[model samples]
Target: MFIKLLLQVVYITVPILIYYALIRNNASLKRYHSILLGIICGISILLCMSFPISFETGYIMDLRTVPWMISFLYGNISTGIILTIIMLGYRIFLGGIGMFVVFIAYSITLLMILFYFKKYSQFSFQHKMKSVLTLTFINSLLIVSSIHFIFGFSESHYLLFYTVFTFMQLLLTWLTVYMIETFRENDRLQLEMQNSEKLYIVGQMAASVAHEIRNPMTVVSGFMQLLYQSDEIPLKHKEHVKIMTVELERAQAIINDYLTLAKPQADKMEKIDVKEQTSLISQTLSSYALMNGVDLHYHIKSDENFYTFGNPEKMQQVLVNMIKNAIEATLNKKAVTISLSKDNEYIYIDITDQGVGLSEDEIKKIGTPFYSTKEKGTGLGLSVSFSIIRAMNGQIMTTSDMGKGTTFTIKLPQY
Candidate 1:
């Protein structure tokens, strides 16, 4: 009788210990809540072991299952370990050598499987589901086989208990996964809503500027044409008319640039050779660089071609802004280098200038409208460039030292 009492105490204590251990690494839950879960499990296991109610047929009642039920609900390694240890202790105290050996083996296996599932299978929903199913199947087999073979218990009595335990555990496991997926969906929805709001604000600002400039642009173009046609106009006046035409064209370009920024959208993407695209931009800008005393240097990391799906025109705009900035910054410098390269899945375009580099604070403010340091800078160039890159699902990053050179890096997804 004393031995049986000691055996029951060991069985009840093991499950509680396992529950405590599982929660040791989990700091997200409140301390009180974790403690409460362990205490409840311990009490439930203890009650199941002590209650002395045998069936009318004289078949032994099994309260030994309470701890396993707790283990299934928790599904954590620490809880499983405690349950196994407590069960093992109880069986030894009661001098049930066969039952003790079988329980120890099953407990260790279950704990190991649980640990592995948590590590590798936690990253994806599908993996988590498969792992849970595998573990449930193994656990069910352990309980049923132990009762049938090791304890020599009647199959008819314990079979119903095992089936009901499996069903309850399956339901609990499904609920846990479902709750986590719901949280992930909510986070994704919030991000989409914020992006939509930003786009709406940008569109409103762009429309106001376009409305203000269209009439003035048309009047200046018409007046310049009249002055050019009048033969009586002096040479100097003709020269003035020519200047008006050029300035009017520049204003129209500025209006178009602003419109692009306000109504930015994803480009029509196609897979193209990234290296070739970079080469073309460098070649096109080469003449402008020479006239301005800016030497262009192009570098490719390897001889192989790189490919990505993107809008070629939008990519050209991004490259042009970066190169123009480099040229303007390096006014009297000896040379500037435009390096192009690729790794496994990304294409990098770096424009380095030997001229005076900007301070950290200046670099941070570059993407904002009207933030240019140039005497004639509109500040909208870099801002428009930023919008274009983002539309293409790419990023632009910059690094600069106050007196040293500055490097601009543009990264695009490669096919």
Candidate 2:
């Protein structure tokens, strides 16, 4: 029993070893460490399967209860299946094939059923109760009935093994529940830490944007005041006035973008139809895309409304940032396309640019506040948009290749 339990524990230890290396501090070493650990675990498992198991004639006490409990405590169905198969293979080779084979087959079936139930329902009270009761009853009936009908074993011994197995199964279930809960708490805390760090980065970007836009805006404002004060200016120099007016507007637009980044008003969230919002933003930005020598396009997959609860203005801001980025990224290409689709209760908008896409290093630094490849870029645009989308329970994913192009996919929950 001790040897069998040890083998089961060893089988279950593989994922933990891989997980430890996968989460190493140096990401460059993570893949190498994980691969090495996995190989070691695989070899160990294979060696364990080659060991011989011999049963004493007519009445060796059944240690079936031990493996049953161990499998449940581990909670990883794959580990349980592997341990059962390996142990059974060894027993079969030693000529303990008859009832041992049946036992191994039953363990695999139980593992599969438990896994299916858990996947469909998770760890709710009802799920746990159902799993426990089903495991207990099915295992008890199989042991008792099989010993009587097939193996011709005694009732007293069968009852003893049945009681022991039940106890082990119960213990295993409790351990699994506790481990799952502990892991979930750790994951929740880790996610919180990551979010806090992202928020800090966003705050820094906001400060940088304010500093960058303030001076240019002030100069533009002063020039506008000078033009207003000059009543004696000649009408022949009206082109100069037009240039000044356009420049001032551009400065104001920059300032506005900064202000929008600094203050993301979440209170304005409403039931926003994604299709309508994207359509409107596409129309509004069409002229800008054309001026920048890029054709802007929108393709909606569904004619029906794709609705989500968010601030339409905020969503529009996100779309504009993406479209503008696409336009700026395009070099020889003449067009950018925004594709919208819905699946699995998510509304997805993918913006693609046909320019020189981001390099591997650039892609890694993306959404990190103030990181930019553009010469004059403030770099707050995507970072601010990322925060806004996340606050709204959405995500922005990017894929880019150096010589090809870039695609930014925005996924938001649909109502």
Candidate 3:
């Protein structure tokens, strides 16, 4: 029985090991991950049910619930339902009164899973382990009780067998959950490392080429300014020069963003008054916002000043970048509001805009270099802003509803 139960453990875990192995380096396969997980769990269910641990009392047991529960908890509702159908269909093919009992027991288990499905994905590792184990215990008890009552198994040895079976079910469930969580954590870390490597490569390229590129651009910009001001030049040519000047300035801004990412300076840290800085940025951008037909509003929820530790200049840059984006996202006559509040740990700066908001996919790509929502944007402003805030040990969070608007929240630890 021990060896058979050990084989059941292998039956339950082998598919998980194989699935992760295949997808470890293939990012494109990640899109079909949940479906793949459902399929693999289904395969495990078939294997476990085929070689179930049978007892002399004509009762059969298997580790099918381990994969079934995992599919529901980790995958979506559709996956869970499909797996349930598969399990029931296979059991009916086997043809026993136990099939009906199995359906009823799993129906109850599925209902319990549905009750906790939404919140289970967000639980901490420990909480997830506890929840899955607790559910498994209840499920095991239900199955054992149903089998005992229906089959009339009154043998003393049958009780001991059930006890061992229940213990093995919980043990195997715990192990499977642990392995899955470990794989997930490792994947997360690998992704973070990949992003960091990309950032480093871009930073190096920017550091090497930005200065060399800036020198000629600066000289050309100076000459363009001279021609724009030259009275001897034809008016049409001067207008062309003015356009060139504007384009040059725009290019310069892009270069500045590259430089910001290229060489992140360790600025002098100081206690910054977030409220005062936010107010200052609002005033500075007021003219620009007015020209865009967007109204700028500020709300202070507390009378007390919110102080945080950071480079004051960098903090202001993040504020200006975020607020400017907010204003641009807002349509003419719409308002962009900046609100400030603080708690014991962190100060929050929320810039909310009233405009056509971003989609979920667009929001995810917000800080990626060279990606932007605007037609002519460089996409480096937010990237630079993100880098600056991270340097100061702060976080930037975004929330948006399509056709409504978006909010960018900057959270900085209070000094």
Candidate 1 lowest-lDDT run of ten: 52-61
Q: What's the TM for model 3?
A: 0.63
Find the candidate with the highest TM-score and give its number. 3
Q: How accurate is candidate 3 locally (lDDT)?
A: 0.85
Give the candidate number with the greatest lDDT.
3
lDDT digits (tens) for residues 279-307 of candidate 1? 89889988888888888889987888787
Which residue segments of model 2 deviate by more than 4 Å?
A: 1-16, 19-23, 30-251, 291-297
TM-scores of the candidates are: 0.52, 0.56, 0.63
lDDT of each: 0.65, 0.64, 0.85
Candidate 1 global Cα RMSD: 14.7
Sort order, TM-score high to low:
3, 2, 1
Candidate 2 lDDT, 247-359, residue by residue in tens: 77776765565565566556887999888888898898888888888888889887877999889888888988888888888874378999888754578888999888886
Q: Write the per-residue lDDT of candidate 3 for residues 1-415, one digit (tens) a residue.
A: 6677888999889999988987786866766778999999999999999999877756668989999998888777899899999999999999979886787789898889888655565455777888899999999988887777777666785677679878999999999999999998897567557655766787998889988999999899989988888889999999899998898898888888888887555558888999899999999999999999999999999999799888888888888888998998898899999999875567888899999999766776787778889897888898888788877777677777789999888878788
TM-score of 1: 0.52
